[model samples]
Target: MAEFLQFAFSGLTVGAVYALVALGFTLIYNASDVVNFAQGDFVMIGGMSTVFLYATGVPLPLAAIIAILTAVIVGLLLHRLAIEPARGASPVTLIIITIGASMFIRGVAQIVFDKQFHQLPAFSGDRPIEILGATLLPQSLWVLGGGLAVFVALWLFLERTLIGKAVLATAANRLGARLVGINTAVILAIAFGVSASIGALAGVLATPITLTRFDLGTIMTLKGFAAAMLGGMGSPLGAVVGGLLLGLIEAFGAGYISSVYKDGFSFIAILVVLFVMPRGLFGGRSVERV
Candidate 1:
């Protein structure tokens, strides 16, 4: 039971990060058909920037704000410089572009941050709280709470706000949205910015627990993408469900099986699920509009 609790806690921590990254995927996918592969780098930026700023004697809250904002700006620039020029390109081209962007971001991070791992103090302090006989750190609570908050905030923004509706409209039918005076190009940029911001926020919250390093975003990004797929592509609710479920799976797997095989098991499960339900459990079948 103790070991199971440990796995659950670790998995949820990792999964919270994945969920945030997956939300980034959903945001970009909704506004533009292209998936931003550099989404993980945004997480690195958040973590690295915060560590540096905090080290420079800046207040933690202010440093976190700046780090997240910088990531948002980077995201916007990625869309403007790379994605916009290649409009109407094939999925392979877009994928390559994003992959290139991810590589570029990591290269920059290594140069700027010196490839060192850094960690920050948790927002709530370094105390462990017990949950169902499991000892969980305050930092874990931040990660989990931050994820839920982002999810709720996203729901409200999308369902209740005109800007959100415009984003959804653009995602649903770019041509129709443009015809109706919804500047989909701008929406795409906004989506990238939003996605980056979310990723950055996740990084900031999780850094205390996971530590921060220059090349940290890749695994988190991959896990998050898997979570998004597990829940359903282009589905925000799917991302959340998928992230939480993946976390629980990893937790139980690590406890029951070998910790060394935890990551391997996730991919194996993804393969099995893909074979059974290609469209995802919650995602509907795709249909192109004429």
Candidate 2:
């Protein structure tokens, strides 16, 4: 029972990061109907950039701010360069371009950060707290809280603000949004900024626990994509649940099953889910529509 609780604790901590990354996917998908494969690099940028800043003697808060801002800039540029021009192209073209962007970012990161693994100082020290037989680090609480905060902020933004409504309107009907004078171009830029910032924030929070490397984003992106797909591509709520579910599966799989196969374990279940449900738990019946 203790081990199970421990597993849950670890899963939730890591799951928080996954959920945030997944939320990034949802944001871009909802706004532009594009899956930014380079999204994971935003997380990498946050961790790597912050680590470098801290190494250069910058304060942690300042480092975090710069890191997240950098991610937003990168995301905006990727959209302007790779995605925007290819808007009239086929979906396959968009996917390839983003994938290329992802590779380019990874290569640049390796050259810049030298493929080293790095961790940040915990926000409130490294002490562990006991909760119902489970021990968790103070940083984990921050990560979890940060994830929840992002979700709530996104929910409120989408559900309340006029800009948020414009974004939704563009997603629902680009022609209609254009007719109504919504600047879809600007909204796409904002979506990229918000999505990348969220991914970067996740990196900042989870770096202490998972550690950070240039290559880390690839797997994190894949896992996040899986979680987003598992929930429903465009559903923010689904991202959270799917991430938590994946984390729990990985935890128990590592414990009772085999740690070696723990990563692959999620895929086995994903395949099963794909076969059984096709669309996913939160996903609509079909994904053909915009």
Candidate 3:
């Protein structure tokens, strides 16, 4: 039971980060119909920037805020420079552009941050709390709490705010939204900025536990993409559930099977989901008239 509890706690900790990443994907996908592969780069930017800034004598809290802002700026630039210009392009073209953007961001990050793995000092401390012979790091609590808080805040923003409704309208139908006086271009830009912020927050919260480097976002992108697909690409709630489920699968697989193949399990999950349920667990069915 203790062993199980240990794995469960570990799963939830990492799952929270995956959930944040998945949320970023969902947000951008809904608003722009573009899957920002660079989502994970935002995470890397957040973590690496915080580490670099803190090392240069900046306070940790302030450094994190600055890092998030930096990602938001990058996101806005991505939209203005790349996405906006290519607005009428095909979906595949837009996807390739995002891929190129991801590569560009990674190359820039490598130049800016160097090729070193870095970790932040835990927000709380190094002490671990014991429960039923299982130990839980205080940082885990921060990750979990942060993820939940972001979700609730996002829900409120979407449900109660006028701008949020505009975003929703734009997502539902771009032409219709434009007819209704919603500035879809602005909504798309906001989506990118907000998504980048969420990704950065995930990096800030998870970096202490996962350690980070310039290339860290690559694998995180794949994992987060898988989580998004598993939960239904455009569904926010599905993103969270898929992320947590993927994390739990990884934890249990590593605990019971083999740690070496832990990453493989996520790929396997992706394959299974693709073959068995292409629409994802929570994805809605689509119908087309011939």
Candidate 4:
């Protein structure tokens, strides 16, 4: 039972990070049909920038804020420079462009941040709190809370605000949105910014536990993509469910099976889901009537 509790706690922590990453995917995919493969780079930027800034004598909270802002700026630049120029391109082409952007960002990070792994001090402290026969890190609570906060804030923004409705309208039908006076370009930019901000927040909260490195983005992106697919690509609720499920599977697999094959568990789950529910657990099949 203790072992189970331990794995569950660990799974929740990792799952929360995956949930944030999946949310980022949903936001960008909804705003624009193109999947931004560079989404993980936003996490890298947040973690690496925070580490660098904190090392430079900046306070932890302030450094985290600056790190998130850096990601937002980079996200804007990516939209304005790479994606905007290639507007109206084929979806495949846009996807390739995002992959290129990811590679480019990774290369720049290597030069600027080096190859060493970095981590931040926990928001509270390193003391381990006892749970029901399991120990928990204060930092883990921060990550979990941050994920919940992001979800609530996003729900409020998307459901209660006019600008948010404009974003959803743009996603539902870009031509119709534009016809109705919604500036789709602005919506796209805002989506990227929001996505980046969420990814950065995940990084900030997770780095204390997972650490950070320039090359970490690729794995993060893959996991997030899998989670999004598992939940239903365009559904926010689906992303959350998928991410937590994946995380729990991984944790249990590692605890019971070979740790070396832990990642294999995720892929196996994905394959099973694909075979059983191709549209995803939360995704509905689309139909059109003439």
**Which pairs of residues collide in candidate 1?**
none
Runs with alpha carbons beyond 4 Å of true place in candidate 1: 285-290
Taking all chains together, each candidate's TM-score versus the true structure is: 0.95, 0.95, 0.96, 0.97
The number of the candidate with the highest TM-score is 4
The residue-by-residue lDDT of candidate 4 on 169-198, one tens digit each, is 887888899999999999999999999999
Overall lDDT per candidate, in order of appearance: 0.88, 0.88, 0.91, 0.91
| 223: Cα error in model 3, Å | 0.7
RMSD of each: 1.6, 1.9, 1.5, 1.1
lDDT of 2 by residue, 1-290 (tens): 77889998888888888899999999988887778788788999999999999999999999999999999999999989888887667657887798899999999999988877898889999879987887999998999999999999998888899998888888888999999999888998899999999999999999988899998888888999988888878888988888878888888888888999988888887788778877676876555644
What TM-score does prediction 2 earn? 0.95
Q: Is candidate 1 or candidate 4 better by TM-score?
A: 4
Output the lDDT of residue 173, model 3.
Answer: 81
Clashes of each: 0, 0, 0, 0
Model 4 spans with C-alpha error above 4 angstroms: 285-287
Task: Indicate the residue-level lDDT of 160 in model 2.
Answer: 95
RMSD of 2: 1.9
